[model samples]
Target: MDQQNGVQIEDLLKLKFVSDPQLSPDGKRLVYVVKEINEDKKYQSNLYMMDVATKKVARWTSGKSMDINPRWSPDGSELLFLSNRTEKMQVWTISASGGEPEIVTDMDHGVSNPSWHPEGHSILYQFTNKKDEENGPIIVDQLRYKADGKPSLTSQSYEQVAQITLDTKEIKVLLEGDADYVYSSYTNDGSGIVYVKFEEDEPESYIQSKVYVYEFDQKPKAISEIKGTLSHPVCSPDGRYIAYVGHDQKYSHATYNELFVYDRESDSTQCLTGKLDIQIGDVMISDLHSIDMSPSLTWSNNSEQLYFLASEFGNTELYAIDLFGNVDKMVEGDRHIYQYAMDDDAKDVYLAISTPAHPGDLVRHDINSLMEEPLTYHNEKLLCNITLSIPEPVQYPSQDGTVIHGWMLKPNDFKAGEKYPMILYIHGGPHMMYGNTFFHEFQCLTAKGYAVLYLNPRGSHGYGQTFVNGCRGDYGGGDYHDLMSGVDHAIESFNWIDSEELYVTGGSYGGFMTNWIVGNTNRFKAAVTQRSICNWQSFYGVSDIGYFFTKGEIGVHMEEDPEKLWYHSPIRFVKHIETPLLIIHGEKDYRCPIEQAEQLYIALKQQKKPTRLVRFPDADHNLSRNGDPAMRMARLEQISGWFDHYRLIPKTSRVANI
Candidate 1:
């Protein structure tokens, strides 16, 4: 084997990523999800068991499905998971010693977010059933609702919570078709189940979600009305409290999330974190490009301390607290840290960390020693001889005098006095921040001889709440200036960046800004917008949460302020575009629907601007993170191709003359 070819694409694809590590009930075998990429570059996830003593790993299932949410049976004899192997998403279980997997329930409708009963004999899951279908509902009349503050009408329907038992094979409908319920977890003694319910105005309304708890054989009761919103209800081990995230219904949707604890008896909740204003959302949350808070909540066995990961003062770290809401730091790193698990005895905690130079690796932290050790040796063999780009943190003042923070990755193998092409990358959520994390896309751009500049503009998280909400009601105003100034600073500060060969690309909010920038000015020679929002007027109606989120963030409701929505829309100025733009979208993306790409492509084509659209099949909004690996690489390659096609090539005649 001539190994100088570096690492094969297949090897990189086959590397397994471990997540959701849970210690067995007896605290012996640790179970976690081992995710690998298939030949198609699609991710295949399965539950695996690892013995702590020998570090021995054994496969628990061999099926053609992505199994996740692995919870060991209380006796540690069986493993429970949620999979799509049966054409519909449902719960399945297998013996921990390895055996044929058995389906637990056969609900015609799909089931998701499964939680095992504390006794491990029963399972609680959330399902979406069309309650109106039994009544034989018809679509003869359109359901009219406001979208992004514009009149939008569509079909109306809803979903609710459900439960099942493994031994009896009996099903119980504890909660049904009142609204949408998701992410249910059982109390320690399995006395009750806590879940989130969205009380919408109609099928298309955007209202904050409410937290509800259902006791065995009883009607569900709304236990807490969090100030902003609540999601992922994980109960503390003692059963006396539930730990969750709380956000302002208006500004919290896009910014950082706040962690809170609720007392079961008092019916009162307390914010656990006062130092940090935001909790890092999930690496993957929604089905589409929109971002939401999904704070990983775990509790110590004693139940006195609840643990979570949040970003405080611009750094993401692991934090813990007591039932009284007193917070303490657990683990701190320079980069983004998450996916933490406490041991059964609550003596040790394991975390997955990723820095600017490191992708991600498993690390174990001792609760008593306060020491951390590397648990897995991955990527070391692949990156031994490879020289990668290092992201240098940079900051500059925007037009409005906001001192914006950002990072610049210089081209690999660079030399002085030689100018190279550059790309300005914008992050998706207008509310999200591009922190000091290991980003594959940025690395690839630098490896191809292009300097990359990314910024935490006015609306990005990590900064204070005021800074994060700065872009509200002004999609392309100060936020646009912050981004433009970042590009300008990169060009001025780095002599290697060829100003004329600059390009720009972003998804969601970034995508919106890219389209807006190309329309307002021709600074970027080429551009690519992925899963972006083009027509704000149509976004509310087409997207899953657009109706409420748009009105809250932009201060416009479809029935109230049509003019304001139109003004902030990027599609309105597409006629003035001069840059060569590429549009990439996922077919199944419902947040920023494929129609957003269609509208931009058609508009750019109509204006005679060189434009192209690359669509991914069955992919959602987060095509980069959980999307097919090969497709993601292809996207990066295509982006490089677009910039290369428009790059300023040196004249051969000039070389001959010199």
Candidate 2:
């Protein structure tokens, strides 16, 4: 009943300082991007340079436009980065010491994710062609703004990789993507480049384009003969070898990325991690803010070791694994440490770390002494006054007997045996895992006296590939049971949960599950589904990967078998729903499209089900995470209110926020 128990949602969503940490070649200086969220909730991302030795910080690039992706030249004299300061993104360069940046690329399409060549004469970057502003002859009919109440578009082109000469600033097409291609890293010897391509077969299905090679003299070649998605390719310091992550297409949705290496001379490949049975889920795949779009999979100057971040023992930690296949843990617990970079000498590693209570910040870890040093500090004043709920890792058995891992955040001011309202929060990606990192929604729910439970159900990543892919064709079957069992286990295992006051909420696939949960059962008193897919048939034509992903995940396509699609859709079971539901959607969400929301809302309304559809204008599929801040706050507020309204709390006890 104290004032400290009631936390502001805005305060909970404060921008922390972290991400895009890059170490200079000599291990003396580090450059990173610090993101600032203003009063209007719009963001301004700027570049900051720090002297690792002196521990002094200075803002290198500052403006309204997004300034990020700082890459150090091989010799470490100059920095190459991508910026949108001129309205369109382009390659730019600045002195490592400090000075104005010079534009290095003049192209029609915006340039992004720039990687400096080892020799410093050229740079590699990704650029997507301008979208077809006018309606065009159909190649693909996209889901359009139907979710936001607009017609879908007929066609458009994707962004791809290109090589730009620093001397002339003339860009030569390296890989023109009919699909979206993300550049990872340049070879150590600068002979060619390695990049990940995303082939958009349907709006719902996304296949990581396999690794392709672009020799300096020859056209780009598809290096992947194995036929799956390849990403985060970084070469060893010797240039004789290359390391990358490969995901087999057969188990695309369910599998984790297996690390592999390619010998340049022998043209042969070897699996570094032996056939990984589990998917490498929760390994923050890319760092767009860094000059090198590929994450810091640093090739320890000796080329014998590779240092990268991976989730182990339920937390994302710094890990060093040798090319010969040995893994060692470096750090753990404080926060999710991602976007790391190491100097060639490999004595120290620079990273961006953030937690629920702390915004992100750039920090350095000395490999030899096992000491961590803080660099630039942001949001220190804001976080200093707040009391945060620490999340505890918990495991519960699923219906089919699989044990699922999850985290529970008890309210800040807790009392034993006082049953509290509960919220079962599900994460998206179906392949993504909800670990120990801090989350605003979880804190908000617990602050309001609701026990929060989030689990890595049947299909979540962080376990191996087989575990991640477990929910593929059995979406509503085992996955649903896993979720229900998690809920059941929470009531039985945790004395804090009130059995009579259960609620559910999720987004994307999680949202689809929310729709499914409400349709099949009414155990939860209320539900909120965000950017969800209600009917599989319509999703195929509407979402960006809809055509293929829909089929892959559900084992049915709109063309060959419409019945299978319908049966797998949540709308098919709408008639059996009894729970009050709130459907939240973004007006600009192309991934799930607004129609999915409209369909469910209309069907439920027709049945007189208590339902409300809240739409965010100009928001995309990631409304809660990367969408507009104001809109994100609004969404949390609305959903929390909906749950509070329907929650059956004890009348005799003193009601406290926490």
Candidate 3:
């Protein structure tokens, strides 16, 4: 492999993160956010506007702050976005022409989910007031309390939807107390907002939202009748229908989200993506971009059809659906459209796309002519000099003959006759699929002469609902076999891979699988488990979503069957592990918790097994995706160094440092 001329871990600085592309109401211009690390190696995001016809680009907003969630004004004269220039993130308004910004919300804590009225007379946003108290004894009484990034919020907090008039700057609380609301441009003719709310005090409530429209003139009316998890509800231009993405919990947490439309005229609701068998969101894992890209269901200008993105096979593509549920894939391509903005007539769509070879760039797709033009090649200069590896899609049969889909990335300087070390990379979400997208870590590893194999086993999205739910009660059974089969198929198809130097690594659920793989087999020379779970019984009581996720995936409660939980625990089979394992975890991670990694490290150390635990301080479950820039580079280097050290020596030999 060409180690010197390829992408390096520090290349993270050279990469520019382009996201949240928003088309002006007139469709003559587009505004987007470009995020990059500064002199201090800290992230700073700003807004930039581009002229559609002339391809002219100019900076719209600038600062050390992170400005995000850009939205166009109804009249297209101004832009509204969230910024963290102050002590906290708040809504800020800037003129269409680039200049300084004027603060909109003057809240002390912070605000989020900002939207404009149809007339642009006011702004709607969500604000939560902190209830500070004197130093006292901490009391616990809730089941659903902790979150991933911000560990525990033992104190009760409720987000309220509020509106502020631009002219007088007067604030009014519309929907308060336990209601989570998001506004649309003209929801209920600018007199109200569309929101999703779930009362924590409700019967057996565990975070499922109900959609409603809260009109200032009228009472809040329930738009969704089904008991399910819902998000991003938007109103049609004519205000005749409300569209949202959700699932009725038919398959618990493993259910595929379907696009549901609610007709205001007929008072009827229907699911549009139920038959598509594709997940209605971008699940492709990437370390380049922030990965929060969507209006999962973007309505067309005419309101006759809705454009949406879904994961299928090994890529995410765009599709349009009409009222009759006639879904048509707008076009076909191997690229991932993480963000897009359609024109007023829905004739031209601006896409922020990422491919196997490209980090991110902008492209304009003309719907009428069925032609696409590359709008911006922001990363071309940096990427051109680097030897980027492209992912080759491959499918293999599982133990039950079920075909598994994945991608194999060869080393940048791959040669047909030479043998290369192979690495199996697993994804975090048991429900997330590895797709046709650019993964920085994979490129870095491949540059070091390792072939990377990533696959979507059973319990992964992109596959059907049955396949996504296949590992509900069988974590180490079929999904385990599917991954092993993928590795076998990769080596079988490409015999040049040195199977004796194979390695495995993953985060979260992928980490659990890596641990399970070491215990179940001694094939891999080394394994790296990150932010993983070891004991299901302890995980059920420790993790943030443990109370439900444990039973939902394990198909049994701790009280119902403790033995079943232990049987699936990776620690139970630690005595059988032969491969040296490296455990990485975040100290403040509430999703999986550091205790999970601590348990594995302690057990392995007690047995004098070759293992090391690296803990990241002040980091949570999201450390890998959006962690501190310096820590992210260290994490990559640590994993690569461990694997390279183990593979460099011969069998039955150890590194002198170890």
**Clashes per prediction?**
9, 33, 0
Per-candidate local distance difference test: 0.73, 0.73, 0.84
Q: Is candidate 1 or candidate 3 better by TM-score?
A: 3
Candidate 1 per-residue lDDT over residues 41-151, each given as its tens digit: 666777767776676767666655888878778888888888888887889988888878889978776787777888877888877665344455455333332122111
For candidate 2, give the lDDT of residue 246: 64
lDDT of 2 by residue, 253-293 (tens): 56566677778788888776664343342443111111121
Worst 10 contiguous positions by lDDT, candidate 3: 177-186
Question: lDDT by residue for model 3 over 313-347, one digit each (tens)?
Answer: 76788889998889998755887888888877777
Worst 10 residues of 1 by lDDT: 145-154
Which RMSD does model 1 reach against the true structure?
4.7
Ranking of candidates on lDDT, top first = 3, 2, 1
Model 3 residue 12 CA deviation (Å) reads 0.9
Among all candidates shown, the one with the greatest TM-score: 3
lDDT of 2: 0.73
- Cα RMSD of all models vs. native, in order, equals 4.7, 4.6, 2.4
Please give the lDDT score at residue 448 for candidate 2: 82
